[model samples]
Target: MKRTFTEGLGRKELAEIKACTQCRECLRYCPVQEVTGRVEISPSEKIRIYRDFIERTESLRALITGRDIPEQLLKDFTRAVFECTTCGVCGEVCPAGIDTQRLWPLLRREMVKRGLGPVGGQAEMPEVIRNTGNPYNQPPSERYRPWFPDETEIAEKAEVAYYVGCTGAYQAQPMVRGDVLILKAIGIEFTMLKEEEEVCCGFPLFITGQHELLEGLVKRLVDAYKNKGVKELVCSCPCCVNMMAKDWPFYYGKELPFKIVHVTQYALKAIKTGKLRIDHGLEERLIYHDPCYLSRGVGVIKEPRDVLRSIPGVELIEFDRWGRLSRCCGAGGAARKVFHDNAVAIARLSIDEACHRGADRLVLSCPACYEKVNDAMKDYPKKVRIVDIMELLSEIIYGQNA
Candidate 1:
């Protein structure tokens, strides 16, 4: 329903902006600032710039007077805004309750409208999504091939549909296999859209201010799932779950036909009800890395940890920045794809944290975290075992054959 930057910037946002004490609490929690060590990218800094711009533009009646803002202003605004991962840590720590998480994207959307943004590596994303069903720009057939169990049965028309996100299909194919295995093992009937028929859930597009193409992309997905009589929409990726559960309804101003449930939520219930059992649980000192989308985006902090703890003999520990304070793995918001080196630098911080904490393994639920962090740990083989939660479960259920 929030269609424009102006609508998002009205009274509530203004009050939050005006009330900022600039205690720098947000900086302490920001992963981008932590990685870059730049005051320019701090949430406080962005807030200050935005407020100054708003005051000047409004005072001069720039909207109606045909006044021109400086090009350098737009360039600086774009850099400060886009460089941030928008992990919602600012909202969590802000004393003034400023929703910088929402504000940043809205600001980015305004930048795009003014022809200022989708900076760095994100500029080509819209065209890529339009041409391909997913973001990796891989062919549809390549995405359709199953990477998990070859014998897993997927129902044709089930009340439950597994919305395997683009990350699951492409980047972390094994995680998709693991998620499907878990669903089947739990005696849940589910269906997945064929890759050719699959359209992205549009989190990448939405966060980067490509709203113009997002509505149609999401609506096509919603209508297809709705037509199939699916009542429960289950997702393995937190990014997709967050967008489908929050963004779709908020942006479209309509309730979804089916409910959105993260795969961990479903797996947690299965564990409690005795439907899901891990007979051969691995004994390892592991830590659960909370993906920003699930924890801060959709408030799914507990379920992932609970799922990990449910496995017998898994000694779970916490990262220095876990749960609400979790550091981004530097993959979300198209950061890894757009700003590759900087994104990896951000990811390295978490990898170093896991190493310092002496965790034998890092259990990640989000495909973004799994891919980004796993890639970061490629050379540091002795540091920690980075495995997706679903993949870990599949191993327990199916043994080495999995």
Candidate 2:
């Protein structure tokens, strides 16, 4: 395979790919490969195909042959590439430390260049984000409503501020409600941005490779918090917290002035310190599915579990694959758009694991994971309930209090 088509590799990208020793040690641990059992679709194989495209210019003949690659082929490739739940398991298992987690996105950028990128629902997000600053394409005014109905007041200069990411604003409305209930239950003093001043967290932009737009949005968010004297930031979305905590500092020259905490961590703190009293006695065999952005991206496996454990009579059964090694639900990196089947396949694997463990309910933290995995379980044997952890907490608290 005279491998000679490296056109997209700049000095940095070339150095990274060249560093690969072609050690297949990572193959043993990749969940996708483990599920599919095909080397051609493995991360290493994907990279090899990329290298061949870069090194062997002759491979361009595939495109030049004037034979249209079936939309399904492109869709499958995009799904396979982006389907990585970003578990970082392969990186932990790799002897050479190839860092496929980072490499996958770079490869996706190249894939997008060939118009073979994420399909279906995700296909429209990049354009929506670029145009309206949010993936849902709703008016920004629709974004600024207080997460709670009427109890909390917008402060002029609060010590803490809540950064409701896009999912919090739109998809995961219950999470927003849960957050408001917890804050109100504890009497924590925080102010939310007026509806007109709130902005998207730009996570959709970053994942879609809209770097320029992302940078601008990050600046806008950082400045908004800084100007408002927000010393702490509370977020309900793990993706938003991960980006603000890690990627923002890396991409921007400065660290954000405000500290970031996911709703789980904040809720746990309140419960532990007696700020909030949650009534226990929810008897259910619950399995917690760690969202990739929270567990692997931010090392937050225990906090969510700790909260679940606090509920009296709540039995938290550990899945065979969990924490940093959690299997993806097939929605991350726009995989739901590119590879709908692969996403469903991955979600099916997770559902089976939960069922095998005898879980009556599946608790998730990410809105995307909740939606994708829930959809996958439609044809599942048992009726497994998919719910956000916050939703469960709200139910437990309200049920007990009421």
Candidate 3:
């Protein structure tokens, strides 16, 4: 017999659903709730409806016949779940200590199993990734050829390899270019998979609750890196790094052969050890916006800040809520594809805050944040330039447009 939807939800998750206090604490912290002003989409309400589903499924009547959750209820629940940015802020603020970031995806996984989830353009992710090795469905040949830094060299086999995730490869090319430029300047020998070999890191698929291709994607990436003698995998995107560091082992069936390190973590060591130097000075006030996966998800709150503080003639500032309490870029959890207006509005919250604080530039580390916030900047009259930290560092070190 096939496994039931409730069967896929482990004991811990079921316990979490029951654990929600309905105290309305998470509602204020939820980005989707804040943006949409929709009470139904609040974290607490999601827990309530899902718990109701579990109850109906396990009832004596349901056991004898079948679970009979209302179609309208399911539709409402799906909207609420998919609309969430899954930024983990609610989880951070939860008095009940529920890990909503992890829990939300499990809920989404069950929804996908039932064929009722992943609204709008998000539904196209799995097929696109399988067909073109990326969610954008762009030609694989265009991944690196258009934007790879000319000065950087890719070794045939090396201990360190850089994974340019789909977003950086396609949407935010300059950020990855800066990543390679800094790596080259630091004299860190690194290798890269051939354009076609470096497929999506499976973050989009995983976050959207599509997992059928995950094991295959994970295995393929691991084997490719292992065959290339990669011992440390370096990446710029926090989502990719988080997925590799946290989830890849489960799919690989063991610890991965290589270690996963975010580029900021890698760069910080170089700065302290005198391997990398910032000789140029920039006299400007800048605020570093923390990426959700990098900060809260992986406990990487300090490294990026430490790096920014090291630059000469630079004054570092903070948002009112930063670090673990940082606001979501609103591009997370694949919500931006379907909830674009909300995504842009949520992103504007970050920009509006930065400009209000008199920041000259809003330095970001995540490509998703970079892309969405850049889009948000277009319409806002009160403007601040958005830049990736890597891109800023490259400009300082190698001159303009470097």
Candidates' C-alpha lDDT:
0.82, 0.72, 0.90
- Give the least accurate 10-residue stretch of model 2, judged by summed lDDT: 1-10
Which segments of candidate 3 are over 4 A away from where they belong? Answer: 1-3, 59-66
After TM-score superposition, the amount by which residue 215's alpha carbon in candidate 3 deviates from its true location, in angstroms, is 0.4
TM-score of each: 0.94, 0.84, 0.97
Please provide, for model 3 over 105-149, each residue's C-alpha lDDT reduced to its tens digit, 9 standing for 90 to 100.
888888888889978988888999999999999999999988897
Q: Write the per-residue lDDT of candidate 1 for residues 7-61, one digit (tens) a residue.
A: 4466877787788887898888887877778888788888887777766566556
C-alpha lDDT of candidate 1 relative to the true structure? 0.82
CA lDDT of 145 in candidate 3?
A: 89
Cα displacement (Å) at residue 202, model 1: 0.8
The true-versus-predicted C-alpha distance at residue 66 of model 2, in Å, is 21
* Model 1 spans > 4 angstroms off: 1-8, 60-68, 146-148, 379-382
Q: TM-score of the candidate numbered 1?
A: 0.94
| Number of the top-ranking candidate, with TM-score as the measure | 3
